[model samples]
Target: MTATTTADTPTAPQGHPRRWLILGVICLAQLTVVLDNTVLNVAIPSLTEELDATTSDIQWMINAYSLVQSGLLLTAGSAADRYGRKKMLAAGLALFGIGSLVAVLAGSTSQLIAARAGMGIGGALLLTTTLAVAMQIFTPDEHPKAIGIWSAVNALGFATGPLIGGFMIDHFWWGAIFLINLPVVALGLVAVVSLVPETKNPQGDRPDLLGALLSTIGMAALVFAIISGPEHGWASGRVLMTAAVAVAVLALFAYWESRAPYPMLDLHFFRNRKFTGAVTGAVLIAFGMSGALYLLTQHLQFVLGYGALEAGLRTAPLALVVVALNFSGLSAKWLARLGMPGSIALGMVLMSGGLVSIASLTEHGYGGTLLGLLLIGAGAAIANPAMAHAIMSAIPREKAGVGAGINGTLAEFGNGLGVAVLGAVLTSRFAALVPVAATSLPAALAAADSAEERERVTDAFSSGLETSQLMGAAAVLLGGLLAAALLRRAERAGDGRPGDGPAAGPDSPVGVSG
Candidate 1:
């Protein structure tokens, strides 16, 4: 296979003046999907009140979305390549809009959960295709910059979701948040039809249907075990059984994909050290960041006695820093100077250091916590784009959708893992310290009917947060070390290239040697 050069890769022709318009449509879809990840948090109180939902039911409202999205990502990507990317993107947008509408009218807990799952399905389709379409329109030389912009927009969506949801909830009904996606989706649909060109792989082999089914079931089960493990004892029969099924099924998925005539996910991609290292680094950063955020939000609200909105507002600085670093064109300079491995290692170092700094945060000293948030934000800004570049550059252009799907799945998996692992640790440590308390912090807080018990629970929770942050720090540092080692080997083997380097000329292969 020959490497594709900038001239040979699809760079939208001059006649296609609508490429940027198509980008706008993709960004809108991307933002909607990213925002939904956290946008519903602001509506949790309303959901409980209006839907008469139990605590567990309310939690499922959030978890159900992630479960479906992560489970179907790879399937969606392969379907796009086998079918048509533009067609899938349009279908996804329509599905997302319909889900939002259904969510607005949902009257029961189960209905709301189902609506969220629908949205997740749409999100999986939309996100997987966006990058694939972008790859097809942009030349290899321009792909990194386009991906950088997409990453920046994605980060901005995550950052703003809470703020937007909070503001809507303050003045309007909770359904107003769901209503917000409608106009955006409508506009996206129009722009997509008018501007985006339909593209699919004519020579693409049949999708691995059995592989997709096994992957979906296995991934869903694994996420289910992880999400529920902290609430239900890890040793519980259900948890253990679910985990066992996940492991067995995922092993089967690997075996099937390896033998499939056309695998949904090519197992051989992992054979490339650069691709594996990039994936490892991405998952680690996501795990640490997600876990830290989960703890910090609780600390700000429960320990510091801040309102939900106040906590969201306080985290605004971190988002602002992330946007500045990712959008300022400085990342290109950093990537050029540090290279992919160095950039990821440096980011992880900053993030780990920041988590360590804030591990012992107190009620009165938010300065240290803020500094830590900023450092983590900066690290993410540098790491995310470089990771995307590395993974995409290492894969064949025809597999862009598969690459995007794998990236999305890893991110969601990392998030679920982080929350489960760190949350379990926090619960265990808090339970150990407070012998009479409930096994979990939330349970303890709920069971605390008296002010005295509440105070004790609060203190225990704070201690748990400290311990969890420390653990998160250590885990991320280990990831950084692993990334450095793997990347160094790639460099020695002459496969590692600076993130901003020009694409191999038209005659070269898509990726470097294994």
Candidate 2:
């Protein structure tokens, strides 16, 4: 559990040239998976039309993928450690491409949903393996920059996804979106098979199967219950029951992982204040960003009269700026000096303030809102690298892969929960404001009162969207305060790093105690 300080030249592992080439392959695989999560959202309209889907069916398309992803990332980490990382990465890439093909040809919503699940499994495997492999391949000194690009490409993929999906939906069919993944997958498979080396946990411990199952079921139930509660009343018996079940199952999961010999998820990391603080802060920031993005896309499309492609292009300011700043390594030095707590607290404050300005989002056009989103984006970019340094530095070098795997799993779950819960709040608020919306509608439309009066009801439904955006701002503000509270000045932390004054290491002499 202790890290060795060394200055030896890093071995090439064959050669440095081969490792860099392989890193490209790993990045491509990561990009494809991350982008697919957000990309399909923009193309949902096209999928609905082509597949003759009801609204609920289209919801399942997204929820199913995310549910599977959120549920299994932790288990997938265990699987990667038990099985070989290189084999998993290669197999995952191939399987994902096959799943894409299945989706491309599917004629019904159910089939497409299953196909997306297949894609998620493949995605979970690839994501867990890629980060782990990258750490194993690169020298410690060069690891941050390499991981930064890897992280940036992941951010870039999500950031650029809507634009790509919009272009395909506008010019071609929904299938074209899945089709684009083929070339990348083909190249990635070839590169990975040729270049990546195999690694597994030499200990060969048994994976906690019961813990994995409970976690999967609990996450699925919780996410589904939250997302569907607005459509079905939150107070409804079915919704209440599902919530109860999710809580029970998750409790069982926590108990099992605690006692299991080879836990799918290691819970002891939270004993370290730096680890706990960083992760909690990450979840809050993600909540703010995810909710805001969901509301803003709709605002641009429905209210501001922008086409999907144009909407994506307009928001390029935030995403592109993130890309630029992340590449500059601007935040790393500051966070290394200020430590985890200070940097995260500052970022959350800026992000929260930014959300306030963005809440004043106008139907007429965007001017200041863009700047607000930019601030939020910059905050997120700074926080990403700082957290990585703090989290990894807490773990010894040998366990770097495990730490990153755990971190990534939590990050993804937070993303799904953020999107689901914030989206539910917005929907519930819009529905609550419907009476006022109906009053504002044309008298003739308002008077035509039946479930069958689709046109009038649909028109009245439109105004509630603006209310949703404002609510999104409130959610972001709340998340900011919560994230800020999670930060503590890490400069005062007693970790036994290079500059720490009187700090115990995370694993010894008196191990981590939050």
Candidate 3:
């Protein structure tokens, strides 16, 4: 079985008439997956009280979904390409709905974690297929605009997840959060079945079973190791062993893909600097965004002493700015003027600045953090669509599913690493400054016997957070520069102008290559 290039399949000259409607359905599916990623954060307290969940159980409940989703993304994407995007989408919806129902009915923390893992499977399929389906339905000329909307919806889900979850937990019950997914899943199924067209790689080869197994095990181990680092000591035997296994397995997976007859992921895609650069930007941005959100949520709840609902409400500005910029066409306009590399770099620069603002002004309260949130949101709006476009354009349409999967896998990897590494930094710094032996801020505060001790713990936590934010900002800033350099190098090699559309033939900046 030989590999087939995307050029083997001809693209439609025009997009589907119902493409916009289909996009809505696709966004709905995307929202469900993205929302689940963050929504559970607000529900942790409820679970602790309702289910008597231990610290380890709560951590697993949060990590299981991400671990499974990240691990299976490459396999799911490849499967969608081999089978059919519409079929995968429908199956994903059914599975996700079932998982949500199971979560709602779960009687114990173990059951909830298992349900989350199931949902992760569905999420992997939904995420890859939704983007792949969107690529199939839209013409290259309209990909940027379509991606802008798609990216905005992604931001919306992340931004609004806590708010929705907080509300559900406050008014109804913890189960309400999972229960809400049912209607969205049902509607998505209806729309997928009715409006979405079936698409797959016509020349796809036999299943890459070995490739899939290696990739899955490797990614799962990688995510597991990351999640464990902050909880277990980073250099502890368990974390070290897991990290080693992840590295060894992923390396083997990479080597196998290069030799496989029908590789699950094309190793050659990295040779395209634009694709690589876009992917780098995605990882760095996700790292910053995820780490910031994780810390900020704690900062709001613990340091500022806000209730869950109030904290969720306060974070609304981040999502609002992202949605506004993307929908107002300002993001598109910026993409046009700045080009792909320029846009990504500029967006990341703004994000770094936002993180810096938050780091420097922590003592000033919510008033100071608000501007940082808005800036971060604006940065994401400007960069995310361009990054998506660069990535999708570089892949042949035939492999769009796996392409989307690859994008997703790296972003998730970045997210996991951000939380783990930044969290570890915070923990280490806090420990160094605090006089208490408690492992966490909440624990330390509880252990504090006097007002002076409580004040000391709070100040230590705040200082640790500031240090973590500055570190994140520096990492993102450096990543932006490196991505810009890579994109510029690709242009100088005569790939084409950065501003050219994906339809600009083989000479285009992000043109698909055999």
Candidate 4:
């Protein structure tokens, strides 16, 4: 039971050729998960009309999926390595398909939430194991290219979610969005069973059930607390209590991981500065972009007076840039020339610049917004692949799933927290800037009470968005500097004595800082 590739397993150069097919299936499944992340937002109106969903009920629809997926990602990834990547992939696809069908048939808000959580579990397994599977099938030389394609598909899926969801909502029932996933799931299941090779960590110890429990609970609580903070009042006892519990549980999780024979996440991997930097950069990137985009969408709809479809269409320029850069083979070349740390810093700088430009935009400055979005998208395109490549390159092949899971967990947490924190910033700013004479902006604006009040609300909201953008820009710039510094220090420290310093081994990719 050595942790070596099985004789029957297919590799990139092996006579049994199905590596690309495996990648395709993995991406297809991944796309389904990614789409679910944002697609439901567009369907909320239809869902409320059909199911009589209250505001809180609709919020849970989104939160349930995010919470469960983030919570279970680490456990799912580790389990995939211990159990078998192919087996987990197949099981995950099945679960996802079943969950989608259940969602389609859900008669109540609670039922939909449950189904969404089920889908989250499936998504966690699928996403966590996919990178491991890709790493297993492709040779070292081909791994980066494989990752580039994967990243492109991932970004595209998320980008197009609203568009696809809107189209379905307009033409069909809200259930159609969930129904669309079935075909992809079916194809993925077939590919996983027939084309994909089984890979597992034969040396992996027994599953860390207790560690998994703590990790899941901690992550779920932390995400919930973050999402609810703005709504419940940041200083409210409920928020404080939940936040404290999250901290306590996570602290316990870290301690358990240090001692567990088979930890759900390997704590030592953080010793690699490149891996650590990559993870931290991913979080910050998600933090800045997710929060900024949330506010931008509101700006487009409320400030610009665009319809849902129109706003989504206007965002297409950003999505196009992301897709183009990721797939055009440019990112790999950038990585080769700039190195991981430098590339990440470059991307962050560009995004920060874009955010600043966006902050300067006026109500009539459509051109400025598009220009800013394009720059932001370009930066994201460059950063995402490089970070994924860095994480894969830094880790031992055997721990690929665990590494992937950690990457995903951090990304999810960052996205949710970003939205919460940034939303709070926007609300606070709006409240402060509003004229003291005006009562409620939403209510006043909706009623068309007075042109003066309308103008004041619009101006104040615009100011709030600008402030949020500035905050996001600063965060991204800070993240870039930190990543650059960490990488440089790690490289200077060298591999050193085993476990004594960061592990930037000889096998680590050239141009990738320690």
Which candidate number has the best TM-score?
3
Candidate 1 residues lying further than 4 Å off, grouped into runs, are: 1-21, 44-59, 430-446, 496-514
Compared with the true structure, model 3 gives a TM-score of: 0.91
Q: How would you encode candidate 1's per-residue C-alpha lDDT over 240-323 as one tens digit per residue?
A: 999999999999999988988888888887877888888888788777877777677667766786665776677667678777
Clashing residue pairs in candidate 3, if any? Answer: none
What would the per-residue lDDT of candidate 4 be over residues 401-453, giving only the tens digit for each residue? 77788778877767666666676677666767776433234443665567897
Error of 3 at 404 (Å): 0.9
lDDT of 2 at 271: 68
| 396: Cα error in model 1, Å | 0.3
**Best-to-worst lDDT order:** 3, 1, 4, 2
Q: Model 2, stretches more than 4 Å misplaced? A: 1-20, 52-56, 435-514
CA deviation > 4 Å runs, candidate 3? 1-12, 48-59, 230-232, 496-514
**Of models 2 and 3, which has the larger TM-score?**
3
**Local error of candidate 1 at 283, Å?**
1.5
- Per-candidate TM equals 0.88, 0.84, 0.91, 0.87
Error of 2 at 104 (Å): 1.4
* Residue range 20-120, candidate 3, lDDT tens digits: 88899899999998898878877766776688764456656866787678777877888887777888999999999999999999999989999998998
Candidate models: Cα lDDT each:
0.75, 0.65, 0.80, 0.74
Give me the displacement of residue 322 in model 2, in angstroms: 1.5
Per-structure clash totals for the candidates: 5, 1, 0, 0
lDDT of 2 by residue, 12-120 (tens): 2222345677677788889988778767766655665577664456556766776676567666766766566777788789988999999888878899999988887
Return whichever of 2 and 4 wins on TM-score: 4
Give the least accurate 10-residue stretch of model 1, judged by summed lDDT.
505-514
State how far residue 266 of model 4 sits from its true place (Å): 1.6
Looking at candidate 2, the ten consecutive residues that score lowest on lDDT are 505-514
